[model samples]
Target: MSEAVRPGAPRAVPYLRQPAFWIVIVLLVVGAVRIAQIAALFFGSFPLATLTAIVMFGLFAVPFWLLLAELDFLEREPAGLRVLAFAWGGLVATSVSIPGSTALDNLIAKLGSPDLAAEWGAALAGPTVEEIAKTLGVVAIVLIARTQVNSVLDGIVYGALVGLGFQIVENVVFAIGAVQQAGLGDRVQPVITTFLVRGFLAGIWSHTLFGALAGAGIGYLVVRRERSRRRRVAVAGLALFGAWASHSLWNSPILRDSFGDSVPAVLAILLLKGLPPLLLVLYLVRRAHDREAAYYVGILATVRDPGLITESELRALGSGSRRGAARRHAAASAGREAKLAVRRLQRAQAGLAVELSRGSDGAGACADRVRRHRATLAALGYPEAVEGARSWRHTASTVGTAALALAVLWVALSALGTA
Candidate 1:
């Protein structure tokens, strides 16, 4: 059966009809009410600290959100679905895991000893409970909108969103805990410290990365129809295990005192714990993105329309870097309008490919939209086909970004008592 949609063909059942949708909604509402009660308690006592944590972690989520948004640029997930994923992580997963992890930790103490639980409780209980809860968010997405998750990249994106949601909410909770632990009178200092340590220093390798790893497995399982069911399930389980193991190691007591409190020592510890998983997730993202890009570009390759997409444009469209280079080449040759035109042209072309893939008759409309942008580019004297090259500007931009990041790290570390 063709995957394409034709007139009178049945559409996906509305989300309202899906039992998973109601299940998710109920969980979200329950979580939200519980979290709100917690927030209220914090606000009644340490309003300033609570506000500070909320604002800081809210800001922290922006960059992660932007980067993840780019992960599936070819076929962006729906905005509503993305919000649902994040809410599941923040509200549902965190709410469930809070009590769940605590109970499991106590059980570990009973099974072993208090000392052993103190040392390994977080490493074991937290990841075991939290990963399962967060992975369920991706499963929920699949249950409600399976068509939206047609690619592995889609699963990664949703999983990352879920992780991001959990990370932000959990950081806020920790920040407030810091304030309470410090016995500070509604001060923001403790909140700032928590932000530096958790939000800045450890944020990169935390929940979001783990969620992506597990999400990759979920994506692979859902999309790889060619693979044997047992193989796909095994791969997905391995992925989830990888996520849990990484999270466990990160939270473990193994390196809590291994390195001294110096800035270099702390950074080294973080790198040791975080770098491997970071590299693995990056490789998966690149691999998934390339495959998705090739599928879409291949669809366009058959169009044989220079006005819509030329050979050079096809080459540029297949790569994130090359796509940016094409826009830059247009901007430098003409003006900012040329860059905008090129972006619109690229979006229209992508839309056309998507419509074609769906077996929809809207290909003509998509092609018309592409032609408008093509004309705009021509009028602006922007040749949208020039390949991008590494230039002095790129080098300067890279150096500048690194320097700025280093400066910020230094300030954060100094504030965090690592100096």
Candidate 2:
């Protein structure tokens, strides 16, 4: 009659052990190979410029991952899916879009006029081509595993990864082409100017944003499976169309005339174009996070054992900063090891809460996991606040990040100056 000896939830299956994981890995490898071949061909034409394009854009790609991760913090998607999303964008989507868009442009030239194809083909073809190509990544993911996306936020994150992948690779191609247009002595200048323009100016509204919007549409279709199939399809279509229109607007030459060339003026126009969609996504994410947190927090009342999760622990999970402060609190009171132990405790509790919230039979198992972590924490003692100076490691990390950002800005400016 004792629940103390009851089993815990099954341990997470290793990614390598899953068949789907291996499939994703294989796909990623194939994509990487294709991209490498293309990059190699480009590099052979002009090595330094191509390499610089990859390196600077490599730096540019980091914030995309970091921002999307932050957006999807509470309910993280599987790492394999995330990798697949990025690969689809970087490798498959980009590879497909370039040739596909070019072919369409050529067709336009034949049908209309050469001038028309050169001037307006991208405005027509790019949105239709690139948005769909990037979106196919999300579709592939959903087809492979339908249950991975539970909310609009998940789709947005996945889409963002795919878009980011496409954007980085695309930027490198642009860089290479820009440098090629310049004189041999003046290549790096163009590459740096490209970095400043693409990475700093236009990047905020690039493929990732388009992908996020389209992915949210896909999320609606999958997550709302109970709805009439027609209704779901409509939502998905609308999301895709929004992405296409956004891309179309960006590509439209009208913005150049209406928005003007002033740096501040251009940024203000971009915000006007970009902010509403972003605000909607953020609002949805907030609602979803709240709904999930409420479910988990509500279940704690039924948990029956205070040792498994305290009220403070339940409250802490609501905000990342609170969670961090709790870890620091644990470290200050107990030892450094206790910090990790406390984190494990929080995670185990969250696991139990998830099982309960999902209506799964694994709640008993999850409870066992929570109890084990509780015992570990009990052995270490409870965390109490202790006043102390900030850790040197934390301070150093902050300083290092600031220095790196400054370095990047200086390089961009210097490169532009030399140009």
* lDDT of candidate 1 over 169-255, digit per residue (tens): 999999999899998589998888888899888999999999999999998998888789999999999999999999999999778
- After superposing candidate 1 on the true structure, give the runs of residues whose Cα lies further than 4 Å from its correct spot: 1-13
Error of 2 at 392 (Å): 23
Where's the lowest-lDDT run of ten residues in candidate 1?
Answer: 1-10
TM-score of 2: 0.77
Residue range 1-419, candidate 2, lDDT tens digits: 01101111223535465576566667667778888998888778888778788899999898778878766454567777787899889988887788899998899999999999878887888888999989988987776666667666678889889999999999898888887787674367778778887777678777888898898888778776667999989999999998888887777665566766554456556666766666766665566556556655667757766766766677777655566677887887788887887777777776776666566777788788877776776788764222234578767888999788656645554555555
Top model by lDDT, which number?
1
Q: Report lDDT per candidate.
A: 0.87, 0.74
Q: Name the lDDT value of residue 81 in candidate 1.
A: 88
RMSD values, in order shown: 2.7, 6.5
TM-score per candidate? 0.95, 0.77
lDDT of 2: 0.74
Task: After superposing candidate 2 on the true structure, give the runs of residues whose Cα lies further than 4 Å from its correct spot.
Answer: 1-33, 319-346, 357-419
